[model samples]
Target chain A: MNAKEIIARRVARELKNGDVVNLGIGLPTLIPNFLPSGITIIVQSENGFLGLGPLCDEPNPSLVNAGGEPCGIVAGAAFFDSAMSFALIRGGHVDVSVLGALQVDSLGNLANWMVPGKRVPGMGGAMDLTTGARHVIIAMEHCTKDGSAKILTNCTLPLTCSGKVQTIVTEMALFRINNGLVLEELCPGVSIADVRNCTEADFTVSPNCIATPGELI
Target chain B: MNKCMSLHEVKAVFRDGMTIMCGGFLGVGSPEGLVRELMSNGAKNLTLISNDSAFPDSGIGQLIANKRVTRLIASHIGTNPETGRQMIAKELEVILVPQGTLAERIRCGGAGLGGVLTETGVGTLVEEGKIKLTANSIKYLVELPLRADIALIKAKRADRAGNLVYEKAGRNFNPLMALAADLVIVEVDELVDCGEIDPETVITPGVVIDKIVVSGGY
Candidate 1:
């Protein structure tokens, strides 16, 4: 599998049956494709859909996700307005939120929206999703295009949320936030030393930190 | 009250510099006929409030592209490159609100509340110029309500009395916007006589709607 697919597959394992999950725009949007069959989870889009299906091959401009990407609707999907859709989120009805991140600090703060001087698109619903969901999972690449680590001691980029991340799934390793960053699992081909070489944040290796399961990789 | 009218009769309500709210996510539930009428009528220096600016050729983006809008209050504008260009060139003023907060602000305006308290943006750049209050040992930002002079919306069906129903995700902001505007204008694909629609399915009641225009039937 490619690096993005690997990370997406790992993130999919974090979901449970019957979970009402919100998938963010980038890497998180890929999790639905990798989720194992027989595990039914209601997918939500902040653009006012509660039960989201796969991306539509036939383009229907009217049916779109929060990212403005074309998508199909599930059998029992409910339509709502922006206020009621957000009420589902802010009212703590959503089970989990998986989002992409530009940087994640030791304290689990996420920076995904803007890059300072650049004229990036405005924040859509990232702030509310990260804050309101019962659980927040981050899926992203290990490093920047220039090989700079995205797992940092502190995020230099603007933050989307302040220390709300619960788990992070990257191509190299899986990290969970406790008192600080704790290394939980490594990808099949990657080693602890390899993680150390690429990751800038300091982390403690859990005794159970082992290779990812074969089926997931 | 007979609220049904032609697109031509509705044009008189729009003027330059009016603050207008439109209901849609991109163009899904937007009032296309009213938007086209406003465009042809040449309203200028207007402030638009909605979810996004949509694409340059679609929905409210058409106004932004025609240079008729002077200010925009919405969540995101990336879908329209022209909006970014105008923003950078100082031709248009844009105020970006968090999507949920934007929804709540409009809802509060309709509900007659002063503001809402939430911790959505405690430490981010969104916290910059807002009042912070602490309750039960947690900090929250005070988001003020937002109201508009007029709201343009689209619906699946409307009766002569103006009770409306929407189809699928097209209901995005129409109902909430209906309650927040001083005058609400709805464009519908189907129009029927009163008592034809089931009371349970009515999304926006006739009391809040000021005008209704029948578009091509669905």
Candidate 2:
């Protein structure tokens, strides 16, 4: 499957009923389409709306996203001030959060916002969602275009959130961070040796940790 | 003596239990007219959400003093003494979101994205366990986008078309809010003929505005 489809399907499979989810930019944003239609998950954008669904074509003034983009209205969506949007998060109303990251360290530290020497816009809401979400997941490519491993021994960039990452899904593998590093699963085409060669972080492939896609199920 | 409406006929809009998003780094361009109206309405169970609850008997603080608000969702409550008191007395449900997260969430609500994921409050009290796995490593707090049933916006000027231009400080939260509500009621200092406003200065178009409330009298 293509990267977008693969990522979307995986994300959809993890969702449960009544799960209030935050889908970050890029690949993570596509999960709504693949979600189980019957188990309606309430999509919450930090800007201030609840019950966000897939983007619609209608011009409803009440529909909005974090980047200020115009979108469609879903059923049962409610509106409030931006402050209340975050209140739902800080108050522990959200069920799950999915975001993109530049790198993931062995300890699950995330560096998604800023990098040294790159004049970055101020960090938006990455820090809050990391600590706020009940389960945190990172989705990104396995390596940079220059082949620099995104799964680093440690993040060298500015930290958006500390060791809060629960699991990571990349083009090459699905790794779960336990006490330290555990290679939970790998993509079909990749081998255990392939993951070892690709990742920079140390891994402990306990019999329970290492699996290839269907092997986990 | 009959008095003509002043050049600055600022009108503030407030309704009981309405959610207001005020612009400014800290109460800088808060609409005075709306604040007064809220005080005058003596609304109750108000759920206020803002960057900071205004000052003592000022901005939103006046409402807090009158016991109008039952809950507060804000980045910081330090600026308002009355808000602090209300919280300590358990008179308010004070849910404090991080500063940047609040802004983005507002922007998100205005933009119509599903929900934005940021690592903002991860691993902290901001949002500890409310997360999910889309991938293996990235965790994000679920920031529900917010929109008000009725929006009270402060703008500097407006054209007959309803496009608005806000003075500095006033630009904070009004523009994003202009599109994120069921009713966008603008309170402007001055109103002009359609097309009279400089297109560049028009931050929020009248198309999104439902009502043009006048500002304070001259």
- lDDT of each residue in A59-116, candidate 1, tens digit only: 6766888877788998899988888898899889999999888899889899987764
Measured against the native two-chain assembly using Cα atoms, what DockQ does each of the candidate structures obtain, in the order listed?
0.74, 0.08
Worst 10 residues of 1 chain A by lDDT: A113-122
What's the i-RMS of each model? 1.3, 10.5
TM-score for chain B considered on its own, for each of the candidates: 0.97, 0.86
* Candidate 2, superposed: residue stretches over 4 Å from native: A209-217, B1-218
Docking class of 2: incorrect
Residues A134-184 of candidate 2 have per-residue lDDT tens digits of 888887778887988889888887777788888887767777788887877
Q: Give the lDDT of residue A18 in candidate 2.
A: 81
lDDT of 2: 0.68
